[model samples]
Target chain A: QGGVAIAECAACHGEDGIGKDVEIPNLAGQHEVYLYRQLQHFKSGKRSHKEMRFESRQLSDADMQALAHYYSQLPR
Target chain B: QGGVAIAECAACHGEDGIGKDVEIPNLAGQHEVYLYRQLQHFKSGKRSHKEMRFESRQLSDADMQALAHYYSQLPR
Candidate 1:
């Protein structure tokens, strides 16, 4: 579910979840709890990234978890 | 430079900066630039964690980089 939607995030975040730099942030190995919180933040506009907010707004709660799990398991 | 001081962080953060859980954050693969900014935030009391603020306040700029580098190279 998340894989299909999250495919677009990989271009900048990397297929393995190692993000580019300070501008982004490495998501690999991060706590699933934290990732979920951030996703919620994004969706609710608390995080306020123009792109990420828009993207997260489109995701269902289950999709957020799948994306969180995928990134959490990726190698940092 | 940072090794002698940061030894305290390893107990929970892991020798590799793979933090334990939602309570602690992983540092591996994180941006060096972001790490520096966070350290600065801790020092200035902006981040507001009792432990991190005290810890970062005691560090010199050079020590911050050394710690940042050490964590940056560790695997996620």
Candidate 2:
């Protein structure tokens, strides 16, 4: 919905946020605050994971906000 | 492989350890230590999430260890 294309995320989190089984997590239906919080955490290393941290690093605050909004709108 | 039925996990993490989508993280192909650490985190409140903490609370040390071992063995 924002500048970042959904395609990049879809590779892991699914074209929808219903990601691949187990290794990935479903982003759909999550609370926007929680999603934004985690993305911030991933970016800041408050939450530690190589891939997520790297992915989050690429996102701007606006991107995180928008993506969180995008995914939160999805059905679980 | 362990006494705990995979069915308990399959509800969310799949019959294997691959989680449903973005909200749930994949357990497959993850390191055993990482899995163990997260389970411990969830149980101990180092990580916070109602469902995960509740689920982890139901697991014993042995169960967490075994499940980590179990899920870690699955191919990504």
Number of backbone collisions per candidate, in order? 0, 17
DockQ of each: 0.37, 0.10
Model 2 over residues A1-76: C-alpha lDDT tens digits? 4555456777788756766656566666556776788889888887777888888888888888888888778765
**Which digits, one per residue and each the tens of the lDDT, describe model 2 over residues B1-76?**
5455357877888866656765665566555776788889889887777888888898888888888888778765
Alpha carbon lDDT at B71, candidate 1? 84
Relative to the true structure, candidate 1 reaches a TM of: 0.71
Model 1, range A1-76, lDDT digits (tens) per residue? 7877768778767777777656677887688877888788789865456888888888999999998888888765
Q: Lowest lDDT 10-mer window, candidate 2 chain A?
A: A1-10
The deviation in Å at residue A16 for candidate 1 is: 1.4
Where does model 2 exceed 4 Å of error?
A: B1-38, B43-76
